[model samples]
Target: MHSLSKLFLTFVGFVGLSLASPGGGEDLPAVCDFAALRARWPKESCEALTSIQAGLPDLLRRVRPYTQTYVLVLLDRPDGVPRAWDDPVLSRLRVGLLADTPAETIAARYKFAQVVPYPLSPAGACALFADLHRGKIDAGLVWAPLAGYFVAVTDVENRLQALPVPQPLPPLEWPKSAWEGASASDSDLFRCADRIQGVLESYGVAPAELLTANVEESSVIPDQPPPEDLAAARVGEALYYRYCDRCHGTQAVLGRRGLELRQRFLQLSYPEFIRAIWEGRPGRGMPAYRGLLDKTQIEALYQYLRALTLGKIAPRQSTD
Candidate 1:
């Protein structure tokens, strides 16, 4: 307060949009707004990550202290580990690194070493040691993982070397926090934020360490709520009203007991349900949904119907 007052600097602030910002209705996480978000991004796959901005940075400052978000490390070519940070043996060697990352900042203070700032897209990862093959840098100063992946693949020829991270671990930007509360819910945003901070605490800041050529985590199946949860039945509920309600009755009420989804679900397995939707019986006046919806959407719709059938959730918003 005194420093800013001495210089007479006025502060102006701006707020960024957040998915978790609550105001309207339903009181659910934005991630649960599946149909709306998917419609907004027709071409992209839907994930809980609304944006890289996860909105934690500023919101957290008011609630708690920020933890170490990254690690800074020393990487040397197989020639061997240099004795010290001020090691005279490292003088005059080009240090290949990405600019402005923890590694670049760490390299700037080197007692005797050369630094090569590899030009790259800030949003993308670069194999830091890939430059060593260009015969330019004698040693590489970079964050882990980026170098780890490249080294994992390229070092098969025994051309590179690993200098173990010093005792305990490499110098990190801050101490890492462990993921805390997995069972937390959207009803308590702060507790949810606490869990988010834990899992993401050690995520790297440098592009190299942050991203890798090989995917560390992956998923083909779309994320969904548990079968017992009402959300799991969302797609089917929507589709039921749009296509099946008129003939089968809203909520598939027993107006036509033979057509009740609950009964049909007991008779037909999930594969049979998928097959019927994919290849609807033309003679029976049922239209195939394949032309109307993608496989994932159709699958979601089926899951929703199954939930309705099992009495896991009462039909919601059913109408004539």
Candidate 2:
């Protein structure tokens, strides 16, 4: 009986050792080189191993490595409808857009064949959230904060999923000759064009169609305040100090975590500026102040920002 017990213990020890070993007791390469692994295993198996190695910490190196890339994601609906970009029934998908995001920009990026625009305003975002709760639309392109807002307001967890746009490989860098034409070879130009075309293809876009597509240029109307409205500017200055100073800093120099409002106001059209202020970029830490501040107050804020940009109002130095 003692000999049998000793044999059982020996068997358990062997099993444990086998389980801990790479490939379950099979002798495998010590180095986690994907190129080497691919020669021995199936492509998929090799890729899985590569991904696993990429995720695990390199104890010897004592540093983490990660790739930075952005992908166009398809938002999934909570309703019983299929959650895929290529669903035949979902060929005509309505996209929700913030005022800042031009419809042309979305078309250029995603290359959606059939897009019905549903622009989301400050109030409209909440209404859209309600519509999403009832599963009205197939999907909505929303930022992280807006998605969070929807879930918070509607109390739905499985409402949306952001799936990354798949790419077989990283996009090729555009050649310098592609931009500067003074010293460009025909072959170099063709190669750069081909690379760009490949990138568009990865996004499911037809390169030929884009070649002939005409995108309308948005008109910009400069914000010009009358000399008498200096009083309004003063009022705007007070409002800016109270609400915007913390983020925008003095004279909109972009204080801690603050975007350069003066620069943005100068570049963007009047309507765009108003929309940005009213709607705010929820995903980018800017809160919607539609109800918090009235139209007149918002206009005042805009005036002050514009004045600063136009050199009418001098920038105040930070006290800190």
Candidate 3:
């Protein structure tokens, strides 16, 4: 009698699990309701997932079909040992454990093609994520630790959501001061906003509250709030690309003229990097761009140069 009962319970469990599979019983509507998923995951998890799954049918099909490829970018290098930055499993859906469905299988059903990984610096992550936000790729999978750091710095902090994964260890919580009181550098804010924007776009959240403000030249360095405002950063970038790119050559200044300038700053630390632009070395024929370039633009240039020095950006041949 005991054996028979045990067997019956086992059968029932199998049936339940089978019914929840991606294609077998009901489709579960592929998340027709975002709120329900939110209830299942943490606030951070919901934010990350919603942004990636915003345009469901297309994203599902793209990620699942052919290869089921999901692009993951780890800001830190893989030591093969799991660290706080390792969130690859949650980058997609909670699947199997959470919903009794596998993310890969769901992606397969949707026709996902491949899962690719790119290791990038914070700047590279920003550019790549920005491109993804613009629909250059399907979606970007990032580690939550870096994402949290970014959330505190960018304007998107209030606008975006951070999703928690299934069996999540514990959501990372940054000190409110990390994003509040201190004056965050422009590059820091830009990277933060880039992360927030990417997350927001993936979740299908509309950022109506976020506004783009024009950059204003200030004589004194005002005590700007933490996690610099991203909207203003972007505005400053647009202005820089339009006006300064022509003279200074923007991020990709090249030729013998450009090389000479880069060689000079190669040894300087980030602080010196800022100072050289602000105070100007003068003797090098490089004019002080401080007054003309706002704090945000200066950060962007610094980020670009830093990348170039690190060999992340290749300089073009000097025809002149």
- The residue-by-residue lDDT of candidate 2 on 229-319, one tens digit each, is 6678778887776566645677687665657777677787666766666555533444334433556776787777777777888777776
In candidate 2, stretches whose alpha carbon ends up further than 4 angstroms from where it belongs are 1-228
Query: Which lDDT values do the candidates have, in the order given?
Result: 0.39, 0.40, 0.34
TM-score of each: 0.28, 0.31, 0.23
Encode model 1's per-residue lDDT on 166-276: one tens digit a residue.
212232221122111122124343443433332222111212222222321213333443244456467657656555554466766543323565676567655566656
Two-way TM-score contest, 1 vs 2, winner: 2
Candidate 2 residue 224 Cα shift, in angstroms, is 8.1
Alpha-carbon shift of residue 285 in model 3 (angstroms): 1.4
Kindly give the stretch of ten consecutive residues in candidate 2 with the minimal lDDT sum: 57-66
Model 3 ranges off by over 4 Å: 1-259, 316-320
Distance (Å) between predicted and true CA of 45, model 3?
Answer: 46
**Ranked candidates (lDDT, high to low):** 2, 1, 3
- lDDT at 11, model 3: 23
Best of the candidates, TM-score: 2
